[model samples]
Target: MSSHVPPSHRRWPAKTLAALTIGAFGWIAPAAAHFQELIPTPPLVNQNTGATVTLDMTFTHPMDHGPVMDMGAPKRFGVLVDGQTTSLMDRLESISVEGKAAYQASVPLKGPGDHIFFLEPAPYWEPAEGVMIVHYTKVVVDAFAADEGWDAMVGFPVEIQPLTRPYGLYTGNLFSGVVTRDGKPVPFATVEVEYRSNGLIEAPDEIFITQTLKADANGTFHYAMPQAGWWSFAALLEGPEPMANPQGDMVPVEQGALIWVNTQDMPQPSTN
Candidate 1:
């Protein structure tokens, strides 16, 4: 997320504007990773009755850990279960994080199965990249020991259909998913991976800010977590149509299909 300086409002020279919009260093602005996060408390729901889960939705760089961007009200929020979807957008409450606008919501788990929570946020304008971003984010919460429906797709413009069980993953386990756009596999897609670095981990360099990989010809990709924490996988693709910026000009729209998964460490050996 870069500064939202509309070109119509700036008097910079054409060459300087091009350099800034293209993200150069020093004289130009560098592109930052934009991630729409929908992190849920407890990550899994064990009980059916009186089981309420809270989700924190925000736009930020998870690996970088700070400079939270303002997130407008989400356009869509819902849960998919047993091939059915329910809208929870009305339940979202305004929340604040890092002195920026964010959102939070609580969902009561009344049935036994996997509840797939999804969010489609309003497009964020990034002047430095000269594009708007719309990330369709999702997370899976297994309820009452039921194991079904973890891989069900909500049918967004872009989304990740998990090949591995999203929940119950161990730290070293390999996670995989297929990147789909308009319900079809997107071959050779770029997927960005980042961990929620909660001050315990440090990047060796800027290259480690967002670890990226490409999906296979069939649109499947894999990554193994190195430690226990929350990790996000974002598949970036260009939208079919451009969107209107504040300047009333048609600009590129970057659509991201993102999923968050939690991993736990193996048990300690004989601490007692």
Candidate 2:
């Protein structure tokens, strides 16, 4: 049998070939929910440990263990303690996570109280979804034995105000918070939750990767951690107005109010 094709049938146009290839392989997969991670190394700060805590800031899909996205310098990064906010932007050190730009900082605990660390990441242009994503993210670290200020608000455009203390939680504790935008509750807001997987555990299905829930009329939502690890709660909403993309076309923006909390397993009974 002849392996050669006739001259008339030989070459296909570039557009035609590209169309055929795409039809065979299908289009790109849908975009997964993006999470802006602002994680503290030792989630809890206490007297037994050191005075300085290291925090890692990365944009990723935590449950999937990433195809980490490059992150620009944050618009704002700071800590709030006892009704005062201090800027930590000057201390940020550039780093790389999964070959993508990330950041880290070491913050020293000055005294006992809840240190609320917050980050307003530069708006990320997500071509996959044709929108910009800006997550106003925060996490609370309890210093020494002072748990009083754990619920203080950071005053982000969109943020989660914790109804339950944000730190020192057991694996099964119910973490609750209210979704607020401009300091007012967002009634019936949508919240997404994901576990910071250690890459050892596997999701049985794609649906298990990110858990979705809705807040009540008061904008309060709750979820009990099923495993011992860090968990994130993101209350999603639309930005006030469309923002122009790089191409100078106005597009919608996704504003996520996110908070991260850590949970640990209860200590087992010691054998004598």
Candidate 3:
């Protein structure tokens, strides 16, 4: 959401690499917020579906500097099920501990396209780390969704992956029966997400991750779905966006809005 997609640790596996590079996100650099980093993020959604992914988190040193997490013992931390915050808490659902002792969370996509996720650090077992001013690290993810504005006028499928796993997906959803103003298909147009992060970021170059897709000449498109969640995808009415680019998916796509998409908990219009 910051002009750039947040950093996903996948690009830098070493603990030291992450620490030294903390300044990349000036605001998250040891800021006094309830922020913590959950390595290998987007923490594999739907474990209930038997689809579980392992995620890890780190502290500067002596693990004891953190808190006595709810999962208990090495690799556990307290969690917060946050949503409804749309501003700083958008795309985030629940933050809990995983069996691997890493932080695990369940996030519902808001629509299709690109979106932001800010993971708050877990409470350290000790009060010092808990009270210390720590900045939050960010990871970027691609999200796909349709009809985010409740108009049901447009629809699309979207994908979002973060640098943490570089290849690790974070969202995948679908939308059906999306139509254009003239009863034409929105394919061949384009789909993208317009976003910003918690930091007071400006300029497109500051963004982190953005995944763009184009509909075939027939106005239909297919993109890789990272995982399961709500997503928001859009089409630029006027431009040359969607390209064979990864790492950063947007910027070129400017001035477009939600079209057709798919998401969870949303009911299709009943023909009955």
Most TM-score-accurate candidate: 2
Pick the winner on lDDT between candidates 1 and 3.
Answer: 1
Error of 3 at 46 (Å): 20
Off by over 4 Å in 3: 1-181, 193-208, 239-255, 259-272
Query: Which segments of candidate 2 are over 4 A away from where they belong?
Result: 1-30
Candidate 3, residues 155-255, lDDT tens digits: the string is: 11222112122222334433322213233554454444322222333334423234455555555555544433323343434222332223333322222
Residue 266's lDDT in candidate 3: 36
Candidate 1 structure quality by residue, lDDT tens digits, 105-176 = 998888788999999999998876677889999999888879998999999999999999998989999999
Give the candidate order by descending TM-score: 2, 1, 3
Q: State the lDDT of candidate 2 residue by residue for 1-272, as single tens digits.
A: 11111111221243355567686777433345689999997888877888798999999999988879999989999999999999999989999887999999999998888999999999898864667889999999888879798888989988999999988899999999999889998887889899999577788877788898888888899999999989999987877778898789897788889999999999999998
TM-score of each: 0.88, 0.89, 0.25
lDDT of 2: 0.85
lDDT of each: 0.85, 0.85, 0.32
Give the per-residue Cα lDDT of candidate 3 at 228: 39
